[model samples]
Target: MARHVLLAGIIGSTAYGLAGPGSDVDRIGVFAVDTVELHGLRAPRESYVTTRPDVTLHEAAKWCRLALGANPTATELAWLPPDLYETRTALGDDLVALRRAFLCAPRVRAAYLGYAARQLRTVERRLTGPGGANPRVAKAARHLARLVAQGRQLYRTGTVEIRLADPEPVRRFGERVAGGDLAAAYRLLAEAGDDLDRGRSPLPDRPDDEAVERWLRAVRAAHLAVA
Candidate 1:
């Protein structure tokens, strides 16, 4: 069955206001296939993609499951700037409305810190190479700092702030990493990760699964009806 693109938005550096003149435009979206495909012998694929600037389209059901888990990347889509939308149907707007329902303290901690850890590993690997510093090292440092900031903000405010309103901390951390002061960078990441356990975070312990499921059902029903 043909795929139906439900929502598409700019993501990555451009969406986060970190893009430079040479940066590529990255996009992420959610799509759905005919209901029949879900029940047929061949299950629908979980995602679609295009090259060039890079676009990824997640199948609707898959997108929901990821969002329910509070996957950082998927959840950030809901908070994108109004101008970044390439496509947004009524159903897509409904999906965006449910973004906050997916926020769970544990999930945010895991996803954000986990991603930061992975990036740190990448930076560590790059540091061992012949060249003093690579572009990826700087990029990874920025992402790690951003993830930590976002996670800390989410816990404190119960909302994710994709574009850091105050980027000084991340900027300083990035500069340290870029200048080969990885020890300082690691310390900052550790401090940020530890903050997740401080006091009682404002975010909920788990997502509102019932509400999210109800919304998903409505979308599926509406699509099936049209199909």
Candidate 2:
């Protein structure tokens, strides 16, 4: 039978929503799959874990969900420098399949938005509370918060990721604010809704790109595997 294991990974500059000047260093990964295990479905499958204070299986599952949604960021994550991933008795094809469903952009954006909003509040409180206030520090603190708003849009609509404005588009817009600019930012982040739209536009043509190909391949493989 075949088996696979999660190894090191690099989320690197990937988590725009989680980023800050002194934000937590993002992570990347190395996963390994056994070819023999790939060939057999009845293999004892216990993966080896290097473990990190930062990475968790739940997050991995979350990534899978977002990727399945066709979220670009999540899709990009599954591909790290090959050196980081080491495959032995693992299911390479299976891992690819998981990434497909994991790329569910819509859901991932929602979850990431929540996380980013919370982080923004945490920083905001520290600066505005009585004995503290540094403009430069606060400016750096605001990046991820804004990105969260922007990312939410890109993820939902499948737009694109871009660096947000410095220091303050609008205060309290991080999580509490609803509608208007905040809402627009979220919509703009995931611009995929445009692609999925089959009306009033180019009437749906097939895409011919490596990223699209890889995603389709993974999803098809997964569906077949499941069936």
Number of the top-ranking candidate, with lDDT as the measure: 1
Q: Residue 179 lDDT in model 2?
A: 19
Model 2 C-alpha lDDT versus the unseen true structure: 0.40
lDDT for position 189 in model 1: 76
Which parts of model 1 have CA positions greater than 4 angstroms off?
225-227
lDDT of each: 0.80, 0.40
Model 2: how far residue 189 lies from native, Å:
12
The best candidate in terms of TM-score: 1
- In the range 1-227, model 1's lDDT, one tens digit per residue, is 23688888998877776776878899899887777667878887988778895888898888888877767788788878888889999989988888888888888888888888888988888876778687778888888888777777777788876666766666567767977988876887788866777747777888898988897787677678444
- Cα lDDT for residue 70, candidate 1: 68
Cand. 2 TM to true fold: 0.39
Question: How do the residues 1-227 of candidate 2 rate in per-residue lDDT, one tens digit apiece?
Answer: 11223433445333433354664444433232333334675842332223444442222233344445544344444544444333322334445433433434434444455555554554556445665544433433444445454555444443433333432453344333221223433343334234323213221222223454454344334334331
What is the TM-score of candidate 1?
0.93
